[model samples]
Target: MVTIETPRSPRNRKSAQREKQAWLFMRASGVVLIVLIFGHLFINLFSGNGIKAIDFAFVAGKWANPLWKIWDTLMLWLALIHGTNGMRTLVNDYTQREGIRKFLNIALWTICIALIILGTLVTTTFDPCPDTSVASALPQFCK
Candidate 1:
């Protein structure tokens, strides 16, 4: 003979709720990431001179706009977090040892946080037209 556990039993409620939230977050973030990625690609690859037009000055010009800065920042944050969360889920599922699982999760989050911080700083504080003494080194648009 076998016994069955109820779906909403007290013992399972907390984990169930957390899992539900994670599932919803994954779906929502995936959809948003698709839009952000496509928009990024369209603007960068299709709008202007295509792939050939994506040199330093092109990036500098784009970052000059606050709107583009915000857009890139959003894309960076969402992509990093979304990927980290998915990897966390995978680590939780596959790693059998508790110690290893904990260590891997910590490492994953640490890398994710570090990358996010670095990427955000670069995106927000990027300088397209640096004040350099050398004139020829600068792009034509900068001059």
Candidate 2:
């Protein structure tokens, strides 16, 4: 016999609102992510000399500007949150144990937060000039 499991908790106004917000966020973020991803790819692989031009200096030059920094940060944040939420939904649906479901959801959000922090830090704090003992190995722009 097949059994239909119902929600553990009855839906309330606040929870319903939260669900609606999450759904809206997923849709909006997905559209933005598509544009950001495509733009990133176009710039990285189709502009100028293409993939061959994607060296340290190429990255440095892009990051040195504020616009690219914002774009990348947005992409990172949106993608991570979107993916994490999707995973959380999956865990909730599949896991029969309450403890397991909660644990997986917490782990997902923790990882998402950690990655977003690290990625933002790297993007915002990127330094084009590296002071190296051997300057020859450094990009020409570093000189």
Candidate 3:
């Protein structure tokens, strides 16, 4: 008896492209995160008044700036995507069952979506002073 070997389908090629894209994203996001994270730390910890200067008022001031908003937004999105995709890779590697892999991927994406939504809302809709009645408790700049 003779056995025949079948060629890979287009679906396999598409899957390969997705894998390559994921790998490329991992490397690119890693490089970007390093720069953004370090810049964030340096600005917050080593510049000007340094860590001691960090307070509710400081954060409020940073958020007031559109540039910082964009910076933080980019950081949030890139980190979440990078981390989720990393976890997805891990799940694919370690999970042997088809069902388990699918479940985990769905769960990862759900969490990522939740986080992205929550973080974006918090960053964009942040009110420095929600209760204006409590003037003293709020930041000095709030008045």
The lDDT leader among the candidates is 3
Please report how far candidate 2 places residue 43 from its true position, in Å. Answer: 0.5
Cα deviation of 137, candidate 2, in Å: 4.6
Specify the highest-TM-score model's number.
Answer: 2
**Clash pairs for candidate 3:** none
User: Candidate 2, which segments miss by more than 4 Å at Cα?
Assistant: 1-10
Tell me, what's the RMSD of every candidate? 4.4, 2.4, 5.6
What's the residue-level lDDT of 136 in candidate 2? 67
lDDT of 2 by residue, 105-143 (tens): 999999999999999999988877877775765577777
lDDT of 1 at 4: 68
Query: What TM-scores do the predictions have?
Result: 0.85, 0.88, 0.87
Candidate 1, residue 46: how far the Cα is off, in Å: 1.3
Q: State the lDDT of candidate 1 residue by residue for 1-143, as single tens digits.
A: 78764433433788779877988988999999999999999999998889988877788888878999999999999899889989998997788898999999999999999999999999978876787675465567778
Question: Which runs in model 1 stand beyond 4 Å of their true positions?
Answer: 1-12, 131-141
Residue 80 C-alpha lDDT in model 2: 99
| lDDT for each candidate structure | 0.86, 0.88, 0.90
Clashing pairs in 1: none
Candidate 1, 84: how far from true, in Å?
Answer: 0.5
The weakest ten consecutive residues by lDDT in model 2 span 130-139
The total of clashing pairs for model 3 equals: 0
